[model samples]
Target: MQRAGNAFVDLIDDVFDNYRQFQHSNDFQQYTSWAKQFKSKLSHALNTWIPKASAFVLNLLSKLRTSMTAWWFFLDHPEVPPDNNLAERSLRLAVTKRKVSGGSRYN
Candidate 1:
């Protein structure tokens, strides 16, 4: 029984390890894409948006960049952006709370 439990635990850990690796790789690829777009946008912002509303436009762009990096997007018909930030933040908070609470009985 103990060995079986241990094996199950190890299997779960392996699955999580694989998941983390895959997530990291996928995130890296997305970040590379965003980086390319970021360079172009920076140049465009500097040339056009900066002179007119430097602070406001730059701040908005900064928020947009954060949302982009976080995979934020609307789920409506048109599917806008900057929507996932709250969900991601809440997930992190829940994880933290779980750690503080010494995990759930099911886990």
Candidate 2:
């Protein structure tokens, strides 16, 4: 389990490395090729790993499969961020207010 987790992290790191390169060079053609290859590789990985995965990991993989399009949207649209840090940051104040106010009665 530990080894599989490490391998998965390494694979993601490699993909991110390629993504950074494409971003730096501003090469849409190369990015498109990479995206196709990545989707194939991801599908293969999920198929290969999901069956043997523990329930926790299986749930994660299932969500990944279901939201695959949204997962890679950032690659298709450079303006879309890969991480939700900005969105989370934007919500921090609201979240804090809700917590302090004992949650809002109205949404």
Candidate 3:
């Protein structure tokens, strides 16, 4: 059971590595190719029967499969960000600033 879980995690890590590579690489053709290959590989991995697949992993994979449309948005819009890290960070910073300002009791 542990072995099956580890293998599933490794496959997921591979997918994430491929995604990060695609995100970092500015080549449109390469990203498209990687995305197609990643989708195929992930689909195959998800289809494989694991002896003791956890519900969490199964649900995660289901969510990923359903979010395919948003995954490849970068292909159509080169300006689109590959991840939401920047936006998330900006929001965090805004919240921090607001909290600090509110606590400071500035006019």
TM-score per candidate, chains pooled: 0.27, 0.72, 0.56
- Ranking, lDDT, top scorer first: 2, 3, 1
Which is the leading candidate under TM-score? Answer: 2
lDDT of 2 by residue, 24-50 (tens): 998888877887887788788888888
Clashes of 2: 0
Instruction: Return the top candidate by lDDT.
Output: 2
- Give residue 96's lDDT in candidate 1 (0 to 100): 92
Arrange candidates, best TM-score first.
Answer: 2, 3, 1
lDDT of every predicted structure (CA atoms): 0.48, 0.81, 0.65
**Residue 27, model 2, lDDT:** 88
| Candidate 1, 8-98: lDDT as tens digits | 3554454345335544575555444554554455445434543344566566545644564343322111123223466888799889998
Evaluate model 3: give its lDDT. 0.65
Better of 1 and 3 by TM-score: 3
lDDT of 3 by residue, 15-97 (tens): 55756676688677876677677667666765673323578766765665678567546545546655678888878977898
